[model samples]
Target chain A: MSTETKQKKMITDVFVEGARKGWNLGVNNIIPNVLMAFVIIHVLNITGLLALLGKLFAPIMAVFGLPGEAATVLMGSWLSMGGGVGVAVSLFNEGLLNGTHLAILAPAIYLMGSQIQYAGRLLGTADVNSRHYGILFAISILNALIAMLIMRIFV
Target chain B: MQEERKVGLVSYLALIFAIIFFSGLFAKAAGWLGVFDFTVLNGSFGKILGEGGKAFEFRGSGGSGAKDGFLFALTLVPTVMFALGVVNVVEYLGALEAARQLLTPLLRPILGIPGSAGLALIAALQSTDAGAGMTKLLYENGEIDDNERSVFAAFQFSAGGTITNFFSSGAALFTLANADGSLAVTTPMLIPLAVMFIMKVFGANVMRFYLKATSKR
Candidate 1:
């Protein structure tokens, strides 16, 4: 029955189905993750912890032409890409990061994004050897770092 | 469980349309042509008067906490819906099958994996779990070996769910605008996308090299 209906489905129906998925993802995933990120940024800002982080990572982040506070965005992204975008936006609103910073950090976020979750979902499900996990993590971080370098040249 | 299907010209057209739709190349083109662009079509919300008679979107300015986040998240919903809708149409038109056909022959040179992994590779771009599940099946069925699985896993692990996730959440960054309403992130949308893809392959090769070196030792 499902296969028969699928064969009869129109392009518009397909679009609607996908849109429904997007809606669910928005309500369930994006909204919650982004809200948490915004609240976290708010907390970090009020506590001056964001400033301290900026100052602390300023030197390292300087290599990527980002402020130290931008480190928080990467950290957030490592947890979840949506959360990373949320943090990036929150900082952008506060004027800590400009458009150029966003461009530089964009690819880097996803390049190394969501590894903690993927470790379980990707590695665990695929049954790759546990011994290879460390190298896999290292390569991803390396990919992200190199991506930033390349992005810096362009934007 | 995908049945082998003939890749048609329509599939290639869909693939091309998908690329152009998201590329931003037609974003500022004159008149009707602008419809091809994602950003132009996604459009913007109307401005409403805020405190002191200043104009702002519904989200307002200088917002913080859950309230602000909620409003911000609200603005993102339409974009997500629209992007995914287009993705669905393109996919239904068989763009992914076209991609698999093109990608199959290059898998060995690019990732040191057999052409058989091509379907899983394309699936990985859309959904991490689906890709991982398929990859496991491929390995268990003896289509790919231990080393190849590790390298492919490296590709999937980093930037998992590349296409769907990027177009959805990553679209948020592309939608960002300056106070003057100019698009932020001046680098074209395709640039970051291409960069991430290149880096994914690079990461896979790094795993390939690590495997080769370790095996000899």
Candidate 2:
């Protein structure tokens, strides 16, 4: 639409339009992703696998000042950003992760988030050579690691 | 269709408003200034009495499994709606166009891509699909070469759909509180956002270096 017609559009209508988009995103993406994360965490908890994973990743996560279980957040976020947040929140609620951990993980989540989906959505669509895909993934993971280190200082 | 749209002063102001609105800068400010804050305006759910006479939001405490997840997701709906509503207003006023204008010049020095990629860069931040499509057009139309495309893809791939994804799902993290009800993250929202933007640039540079080194062989 032209600027003139857009200016003629009601502000309220514009807001409603955006809100409707948010509604769809929430229902279609956030809700499902979060629900799946929660269920995954629940299973991990009941099966004692969460503890084992934490023990395994504790030393590595410590470099970023996060708990070992925090690795799950990064793993989940790698699939979907919403899922990562859900996992982080679930850990926080379980008293496994504190506020500081969430703060540190926040930016890192999206920095490397959604690589699996974006491999197709972004790289494939942009027609970037598949040969360069490994480097692209590495760069994003490096970015997330650096972000966590930076955020740890602030929080 | 790729002609540059005129960015007016209103667009710049809209962009500024969008920044402060989501920046969490005035979240604790008293009086009218607080209204400029996203978290302040998003507000909190009312409390209800739970076990031990303690107050809890509708999601309550010690819940488990899909049922709890459903309720937790439900609580996030209004926040998502409000965030998107404000974002829509900002976009309608041309905040993005203003951003494109401001960013176009910096694209060369920063990402090593042409100014023409500015629109695609901005679009990518909002929607991955739009950005990717535009970027493909840029390459196919000979606006950018293969190496530049790789660098640009690195930027988009790292934090694709940044603004939309952040405000929609990532906003939930900003809402988390300690047991005593203090905000979970005292760091301003803008800080993380800035870090992501910087890292995106850094990642793109990494790709640029990689492509250059490999091509030399």
Candidate 3:
């Protein structure tokens, strides 16, 4: 084969290999999230815990123009964006909610997932007490609350 | 660093490309197939908890159909694990040391975060939850001081998880634009800005309070 053709083939091979590895990691991260979501859903269903929690948080959720039901989605969003979006889409369909409402409500949905915690874990492999773990929880939770408040004003 | 552990630049670049491709392909494919349709599966738990137990509900669709459930799970899982593994491998290869050395002076003074902390921050910005896992690793490393960790946390909390913006928001933006059948740039611009605005407000406070607390400690 010509040098140019060989080089092209090599590049393609490298790209494919990288993609394979990337997919492997993506699948690993997703498993827990999917499994957790399944477990959480099942637990909520059997125990009626989600409903009780929703009622408890309903007043606070109303502040952000979300129903008491939205707490689950918001919580899901905190751990993984997909879970949150999944919940959001479900809520919209269930309530027949309009786009504008979903738009205004989407900010909080986007928040959470607590990235700082993830950072801590990566860095933690080097040593213990990255300290960012707890801080991330605080930052993510507070951010969601504050963002929700401001977004609500416009809604 | 051990020679056996060293990863070349090509390895890093290859990993990045692969990640972008798989994430884009799988996430979109899963969405398209309606793997997360929610009709087949039910609530997270069988019952409710907390106040107003009956009021809260977790929604699920799409059953444990081998194809859809497996596909959806695969799409989401790999994003986090691959990013984490790549990051670990890269760091293990001491790639960050060279980069960190170059940025120490600037990062130390301005961001007040250790050079090692920057990698996690950048990674988290790409994907939030995965970043959290990364951050936890960093925390366990003792490479980051308390002050730096707090600052790092704040930065990530504020700005991380843009992956969602790129795919979810990007898709929505396109759909909205298509519905209008216009070449307008309004939706494209607004969504990013809104996401950014939310990040900034929280990011600033997270850093501010963290700095203050560290000073007191």
RMSD of each candidate relative to the true structure = 1.6, 1.4, 11.7
Per-residue lDDT of candidate 3, residues B1-217 (tens digit): 1112234575455444433332322323444443322111111223234364433222233343233334445434333333334344433334444443444556666666666655555455456556666666666677766565556556555535554443333223222211122321222223433554456445645675666877797
Kindly indicate the candidate among 1 and 2 with the higher lDDT. 1
Q: Which is the winner by DockQ between candidate 1 and candidate 3?
A: 1
Q: Would you estimate the TM-scores of all the predictions? A: 0.97, 0.96, 0.49
CA lDDT of each prediction against the hidden true structure? 0.90, 0.88, 0.48
The candidates score, on chain A by TM-score, as follows: 0.92, 0.95, 0.58
Compose the digit string of candidate 1's lDDT tens values, residues B46-146. 99987898899888887779899888888888888888899999988889989999999999999999999988998999999999999999999999998
Cα-based lDDT at residue A55, candidate 2: 98
Which pairs clash in the backbone of model 2?
none
TM-score of model 2 relative to the true fold? 0.96
Best by lDDT: 1
For model 3 the local lDDT of residue A32 reads 41
Candidate 1 C-alpha lDDT tens digits along A62-118: 999999999999998898888898898888878899999998998989988999999
Off by over 4 Å in 1: A1-7, B51-53
- Worst 10-residue lDDT window for candidate 1 chain A reads A1-10
lDDT tens digits, residue span A1-155, model 3: 33344345443454345446555534554344444555555566468876787789789778777777678877777666656655444344333233444554456555565343444443343232445556656666666677666655544
